[model samples]
Target: MTVFSVNHVTTYAYAEPVRLGEHRMMLRPRDSNDQRLLEASLAIDPPPKTLRWIHDVFDNCVAVATFSGETRELRVENRITLEHTPFEGDEFLLDDSARFYPFAYDAEETPDLARSIERHSPDPSGELDRWVRHFLHPGRPTETGELLMTLNYAIKEGFYYERRVEKGTQSALETLARRRGSCRDFATLMMEAARALGFAARFVSGYLYVPDCDGENRHLGGGSTHAWLQIYLPGSGWVEFDPTNGIVGNRDLIRVAVAREARQAIPLYGSYFADNATASTMDVEVRVRQSPSCELPSAPHRNL
Candidate 1:
């Protein structure tokens, strides 16, 4: 078992004082069978007038903060400690029916997963479909797990990792054309590609932990929030894949929220009302490290 502490700070600096509106944040890590949240706290400068927590359609915890006064700078800090049990890609066993490509999902589960399987981006040219087909050889059997892993690694090796501070994810076609993009862009591409292959794929937004020992092998998209995708497989359920780092399973990926599309999983967003007081700059800092002490009990704990 590994315990980790994550500190995330986001600040928005304006040209002058402005009336801040309600801000929604998704900084808390999700508690699952393999991962447990130990403790969490959030601090905001010029304290919010009211703060409330609610679960969205996807059952992700979201914090909504409303402010009354005005300030030139808006800052939000989140700290959390979690216990994670790593799972490797090879550990999962797929059902016999889904062990190979060109499989079908259970009839009952198809309804719920249909939206995820449907491609969100338009692929009129069938470019993305042709790209995904490369993993499957004609007139021969293809191992499902191997195909997915190869695709994940292909993105990491084939494309350049570009850090884009701008909002929104690029369409899969855009990433394919450039052969380079941010972590989210890579995730979006993988998600769309998997969907085209008749798989239920979702976008995951969270923090990634990189140990000091990694040194030269440190993962990319670490100093800030990271993005990845999960594909649902029979027997194994939803399996994670980080194309940006060629990571499989949960490993060092700490998930905060999951969405059918990237736009639905913004970490922090809000607007400020001001006249002629345009925003000047925005900065984000994230740090994820292994904790020195483990406080979780040996017995398995249920998610709260």
Candidate 2:
């Protein structure tokens, strides 16, 4: 079991001060088998007059608060200590998942996922077609660890991660054409690619305690969240892979929830416009610490 100190902070600033109104929040994590939640607390500047907690389709904690004016400042922070216990390692892949995920026998109406399979047909675009080709080729790797290592190298070898918010439902071909994507886009593309090749891949959203991230960092879930992809293999179970960063594993992944797509995994997301005008601003920060700075666990294998 690994112990970690995780903290997250998010604040928003408006272009101009206007009459503030009621605000809704979906900023808390829900229960899941992947990660255990120890404790959580939320603070809002110019505190809200009323707060009503609601659960979304994915069962995430959503809060609605009444505010008086525009330029409202909101902050959410969570402290959690959890362990991986039985991590899904290289051995798990060869025994169970390798056989189960590669066939389309188990696609169901999973309401929790935002991106649905509108239609299932052969992808003509070489984009996913190529990845599928690789996934299906003989000599498939023996474990999830090898899959992560191989994918990390492939993404880094193909393109670079620049700053930008990916828009719309891009076909696997479209993402392949661009060779660039946001956290959600990258993870989505990976999920599609995995599914195309017959793998049970899910989306995950939560905090990643990175030392280099300062003040406020851009969100993978974007706007108000962070996201990544998870693949289930036997014995190993579900393991996370951050195609954006190229290096996050059982040792680092602070999982909040696992669902079908980025939308379901978002921390705070809803649609509401008071008047004819639409307006919104978001801020986010993340911090990670280790007590005593004792001997570190084994470092993850480097990407090729």
Name the candidate that leads on lDDT. 1
Cα lDDT over the full model 2: 0.55
TM-score of each: 0.94, 0.70
Off by over 4 Å in 1: 88-90, 293-304
lDDT scores in order = 0.89, 0.55
lDDT for each residue of candidate 2 in 1-304, tens digit (9 for 90 to 100): 5455566666655454544566565545554565565666777776767878877665666777776544434555655565433243433334543443242323332332224332232476455757645643366543444554566556645755554533344444666678876666777777777666555677777656443234443223322345678765444455677776664454455666666776555554333334446455765666655443433344445321
Candidate 2 wrongly placed segments (more than 4 Å) = 19-26, 30-34, 68-72, 75-90, 93-126, 138-149, 165-172, 211-225, 234-236, 247-249, 270-281, 294-296, 300-304
| lDDT string, candidate 1, 1-304, tens digits | 7888899999999998899988999988788999999999999998999999999999999999999977999889999999988863325678899988989999999999999999999999899999999999799998898889899989999999999999889999999999999999999999999999999999999998765562454578988999999999998899889999988877788999999999999999998998884856889999988877423222221110
